[model samples]
Target: MAEKFDVIVVGAGMAGNAAAYTLAKAGVNVLQIERGEYAGSKNVQGGILYAQAVEALIPEFRESAPLERHIIEQRIWVLNDKSYIGTHFRSDNFNEERPNRYTLVRAQFDKWLNGEVKKAGATVITETTVLELLKDETGKVNGVRCDRENGEVRADCVILCDGVNALVGSRSGVRKEINSKEVALAVKEMHFLPRDVINERFNIQESEGVVIEILGTVTEGMLGTGFIYTNGESLSVGIGVIVSDLMKNRINPSTLLEKMKSHPSVAPLLKGSEVKEYSAHLLPEGGYDSVPELSGNGWMVCGDSAHLLNAIHREGSNMALTSGRLAAETYLELRDKGQPINAENLKKYNQKLENSFVLKDLKKYRRMPHIMLENKQFVTMYPDLLAGAAETLLRVDGVDKKTKEKKITKDFRSARGIFGLVGDAFKLVRAWR
Candidate 1:
């Protein structure tokens, strides 16, 4: 006979912690297993935390969670080698009593979240890898087999939150192996700076932060984006590229990140910062089409494992947290109704997601990924054209405003024919809509 629990959650990232905490808080016997020394040891993120998602799980999280800074400003930059055309949104509204978003260090935040899971009465085992899913002859998963000796544990249901490269799900034939074309490889560095220096450079006060989202030639025509996030005392800077594009273009992600750091527009912000940490992770960018089977007999997949990322908005954590909570809620619903944790009953989990913003937003921009990947001009030609037009209009080089406007129009026509421009606009609108 093996030890038994009501539910077993694999991995301790956003999804896993959320699932385990939700289940345990509901008084369900949940066991969360992590392969790392502790929760968040293997997790990496761009360091943005969506407040509403976590608030739904733990309303008072702001009082205890290890938060870095609340974002008060956002900048989106279309970059060239020398210049950028960008938009900035800053408001006093973000400084309200309850901020909408914050920057956090994943390792600290995950550890804090896992602590909540434990305090809620869930069993957690760290540094132990679940080797495979345990299934009965009926082809229904019921538990997991871990690397430790005699490490078999039974559970009525299993929630896979193992991440983009989850092995247990793929190995157990629960989901298809990830496709390179549908994933992205992101490399990031943690640059430490004094808190006051950070605030001064970004023109903010303590507890206020800034986020810069970058697009354009920094990726060298690859399908991806770069970002810089301000923390309380550090900056998170990174670049991500489609794995297939990296393979096809033979681009090195680390080298690409280095080039982005050296960009004239980006370099000044990072001046005098000391590099303290570097990490890389894969993210699912497949949108609605790439989502795998959500649930089956005795098992459910959530978060990155289910391909629940919304790349267009750079939102992963919120989806992960929300999906995890929904999965747990689904199990609780079935249990209360005296329904079996079989494929038929678990279908409700998928329905729940479909009704949430997690799936709705992804479906809305489902075609954007394919369109962006197919059109290189979005990351290359268009960025350059925008930068050039900005320069043309602002240089004050003795040319009349009307003449400068005409030159800008001519430049666009010369770079991309009128038909090409119209076609690109159509594709963008079609995908975005």
Candidate 2:
């Protein structure tokens, strides 16, 4: 006889864990499988977690989860060769009873989340890969086939929370294969430093953290961005570029990361830190147009597998958790209604996402990916111009303020003609809308 379960969840990442925990807690028999040796084993380093999303799944996570720091300040930098222009938002409000955001080492946090799933009574099997989706006579997904002998496991439904690669779904013709242009390849490094040194450099007290996002020249005109995130005793730094841009520019991501770290403004923060880990991953940056079919008969897709990332806001985990919760909720509701997990009933998953901030946010910035791709000036020309303007305005070379302003204006016109400037502005406005 074949093994059977109420549901089979593939890949025990944020979305998978969230869905499995929710289902098991509701007394639904769920089998959660992972390819890694253990949960989070695949994650080599760090990221920021928007607290609200995970809190909805596990309210008391802040108390026990391996959170690195609570973000108290966020800085956005536009950098040239030697200098940067930027703004920051910091507030004591972030230190309230329940902080809004946090820095987390992905390995630790994911293991913790998976532990919760196990405690909730879900059967979790690590070091197991689901080779393909199993279909019934009517051609609906109802189980998965694993690598082991007699590995077929039947379930009423299957939930795919695989990462951006999403191999099983794509192989089964359930979701489209990710396009190189729609995704980004990011290289990240973990620089380990002492707690005191990290605190001294970022000017924060214990438990408080800072995040820095950089753009312009770092990618050498490629459409990409770099970032530095502070952890408890280390810093997470990395750079990401569109795969197509990398191919067109013929640039290596590692070299770009080295350049970003050596920038005068960035180097000092990691003067003597040791390199702890390095890993690369793909991100879904294609915005709304790249999202594939999310649901079908006896199956649902969530998280990066569904292209649910919001690149504009740099949010992924929040969307992952939200989608997973919604998928589980949809399954429970439809089952209660005595409805089969058919194409028609599973669309409640889509309806729930559309009604929530997930789809709404992605739809609002649907134009940004194209805007970034088309406008090279935003990445290269503007940063140098902003730096030069700042230098002129701040350094008194005995030039009058009016003359300096006129020179800056002339430079802008010379670099990007008046029409070009207007067009860029219009595109920005439209994209932002």
How high is the lDDT of residue 335 in model 1? 96
| Candidate 1: 10-residue stretch with minimal lDDT | 1-10
Report residue 359 deviation for candidate 1 (angstroms). 0.4
Deviation of model 1 at 9, angstroms: 0.5
Q: What is the lDDT of residue 317 in candidate 1?
A: 99
Off by over 4 Å in 1: none
User: Local error of candidate 2 at 73, Å?
Assistant: 0.2
Q: Best by lDDT, which number?
A: 1
Model 2, range 74-132, lDDT digits (tens) per residue?
Answer: 99999888999999999989888789999998888899999999999999998888889
Best by TM-score: 1
